[model samples]
Target: MTNAGPDGRRIEEALTGGNMEPVVRIDDTVRRVAGPWTPAVHALLDTLVRGGVPEVPSPIGIDDQGREILTYLPGTVLDDVPPETRWSDSILQQTGGLLRRMHDASTSLIGGGRHVRTWRSASHEPVEVVCHNDFAPYNLLVTADRLSGVIDFDFASPGPRIRDLAYLAYRMAPFAEDALDDSGFTAGEREARLERLIAAYGVPFESSEVLRVGADRLLELADFTDARAVETGRTDLPEHAAMYRRDAVLLVGLSSPQH
Candidate 1:
């Protein structure tokens, strides 16, 4: 199930790092099917690199096969870290700090012709920076007990910083219903972790605001997933949509003043 290159190196190994797309590793490079928005993603990567953000891949031009090319970051991609280490403060803090770096680096791109840029995700108002619309642990690369790199820019777009942070908090802070609460933290501990992550990111908003936004984010995700399920006839998406709605409702209560 692999191919060899002209130099006798393994040319193509199907990568299982992401769920939405088929990705392959070609020696030191990664390739995936590109879309019209790819050039803008490449531009954003270039800007991030120039802005001194570490641990992000450098985008190469498209290949003759019309696949987007990028440097392969070698590390264990933490799709779902094991329960033993899942709630570790180290990873949470590291993820928060890394997100801050990406957001800060991406600020330079805001209002610099980003309105015309083609992104897979629609731009949100009050665009302070280019948001990595999917910033959860699944997109993180870990090495030697630390964060090494981040991947998947297909959803990058101009949006409020909280839009991205809310999703991260949903996964890491784990604003989930009982069925989805796999982070091994109690309610109080989960709240504490949420605060830690927000503090690490150095954002000015209260965590209540973040939880409210997180609820809205989940509702949007549910609607999108439902539509995609109908279009693709993907059986799993309906369940995903249901889970998002349940979590969104939970987050609303958590964000309420009475809570």
Candidate 2:
């Protein structure tokens, strides 16, 4: 599905015009739409303007038609299995550091404002940086086992750091039983992989911070999905939404402070 405008015009012209092969190359350009979400994305890129965010595409501007233009970021996106394993210690560490930096930079922009909170578990105290809410394998660009860049900032938002981290963990180390197979591993093997990932990212095992808030995040995702489905008049997503809600409850049940 292309990112189309409300009037359904293709707006990701710059990205499509480029012949450069991105990690996750999409022939169909993301059509831009003018709305609350698009401007929020623009605000995020604005925040990253001064900081040394490596290889980020430059935003052109909001078009008269209300579409946003951005330079196409380059790198290889490792979407699944064999590619997913390409995620190395350096990449995880870099990603962790990048996230930290983004959070630090975001403090100034959204430090004290009534902003929209995407996750219900998120504290409404003050907004942190604009999180690439969908930071995952598909959105990341990798080269030689290191994170080269990121793409798809459509879900960017001002929110808590933990919310972004939890979303990453949820995507990377999902609660689904089949995720192991998708990653080309057995259940026991996948567990080991997850342990290594957490270690590589320096996520404290004893903290229980990610686990404590996981259920709420999942519920929030479910609610968001349900709302989107309704808005788009699509009934196909409710089953998956229900599954996520159930999985979130299961995850909460499995949580332990002992790590």
Candidate 3:
């Protein structure tokens, strides 16, 4: 691909890879190609545009080559943290509110949206809106410990609210020894932070019903990951599946007050 833009300055700064397409950061824009998940992503962007989601970037339309262009959101994504920074209650609370807002806006688009897999369970009913399936810290932009924006909606789809929440908790919780490697904190500390986050989101943290449903949804995610890995012939994904199982065990164990 050519590196020069209309102004003759170097446009490509970085490239984020995916199974479907490549995400290139150029000057002040992000260009994404039509990947396997393109239809789902386009559906999500359409919903966000119609709903007027404030923090998400507005899609500028597709190029002649069918690549999507979006305004670049400024801020650092919290994929990795420096040792000095701590995961505090306030940050967790903000994240909860952000998630709630996104879920609320997504209701209208729930069943109409498209994506990789359908997230359905007996407890959590499906809703219609764009779901950012990978709404983890890595995809979120933060400034001064506050959520500024989000990116990389490659896995966005229509699904249940709890499905998204379960994924978020799975990624955010420090249930294993290696969990703190990225967050720079201990498992206990991260659990406490996650508890505060759940409470802040107005989710019933103490309800047996909620816990049961969340656990089931989490297991569903594990099954999905394992199945996808096997189908795609990814040899390395079984390790992830094993880690998730271990993590699930630790999560259940820690949920008991006696633990």
Candidate 4:
């Protein structure tokens, strides 16, 4: 049996470009095998779109093969971004502002009765919004000096707004030990970066709180990765999980630094 897209054209070419999900790009759309929660995710995406949220991908209909389709967005996803380009304080500030806009838009979704179950865990607090959950530089599409869009809502779930911000701060401001070597941010610079991001997001969070949440988030990610590795029988996944576990150490090291 062959898989077909919404237009009945054969789904052509697996998009190896993605880090997760076996996505195939057919014509102008990207299709992936629908998970059980995809329908709920589609609902979330629809709400975000109907709410006029920016930086989110356009969700198309499902296909006969039970694949979810989304409009293919264009821009750069920087995994190997230059140190100079990746660590710009102004760019980080702008990116944080975008996140604030997203969080604000998502605030309307609270208690609206739309939720999906995924591997990503939510924090224990009053629900602020459904979060991107995996917001990071690699998931973001950047054009020139500004972030064009945010992608990969697969892990969207309900959580405290700051928990979402914590994950973002972990990756963007990178509240970890090797922030200096890995991201060209000095100890004091990283503190400033965390403060700048929180301030840009226009939220009242102690820079210290972001760090605490970020550390806890890493521990959760480590466990999630470990369980996935066991279930999928992927040995490499554990090593990857260990990397995040190692970051826990780095995170602890940062506790002494005055933010």
TM-score of 4: 0.85
Residues 1-259 of candidate 1: C-alpha lDDT, one tens digit per residue: 4468789767688887644778988978999889989988998999899988869999988988899999989887765556546567888898899888899998877885535778999999888989998887778888767888889999899999999999999988777653245666788988898999999899877999999999999999999999989998999989989999999998999889999
Residue-wise lDDT of candidate 3 within 58-101, one digit each (tens)? 67767666788887788776555442332555656777777777
Q: List the residue pairs that clash in candidate 4.
A: none
What C-alpha lDDT values do all the predictions have?
A: 0.86, 0.58, 0.63, 0.74
Give lDDT tens digits, candidate 4, residues 1-259: 6668899877687654324667777777878767766765677777777777656778898988888899877677744466676777877887788777777776665675565345234445677877777888778777776677777777777778887788888877766443446787666777788888989888889876777778788898889889988888988888878878888766666654652
Q: Identify the runs in model 1 with alpha carbons over 4 angstroms from their true place.
A: 1-10, 177-181
Please name the candidate that would achieve the greatest lDDT relative to the true structure. 1
Clashes of each: 0, 4, 6, 0
> For every model shown, what is its TM-score relative to the native structure?
0.93, 0.71, 0.74, 0.85
Write down the worst ten-residue block by lDDT for model 2. 17-26
Candidate 2 lDDT (Cα, whole model)? 0.58
* Superior by lDDT: candidate 2 or candidate 3: 3
Candidate 1 or 3, higher lDDT? 1
Model 2 agreement with the true structure over 88-204: per-residue lDDT tens digits: 445555666665666666665675556543331234323555666666666777666666766667656666667676656555655543243565555455345445555645546
Worst 10 residues of 3 by lDDT: 115-124
Q: For model 4, what is the alpha-carbon lDDT of residue 64?
A: 85
Where does candidate 3 stray beyond 4 Å?
1-10, 16-21, 35-40, 49-52, 83-86, 111-124, 128-130, 181-188, 205-218, 223-236, 255-259
In the predicted model 1, the residue pairs found to clash are none
Top-down lDDT ranking = 1, 4, 3, 2
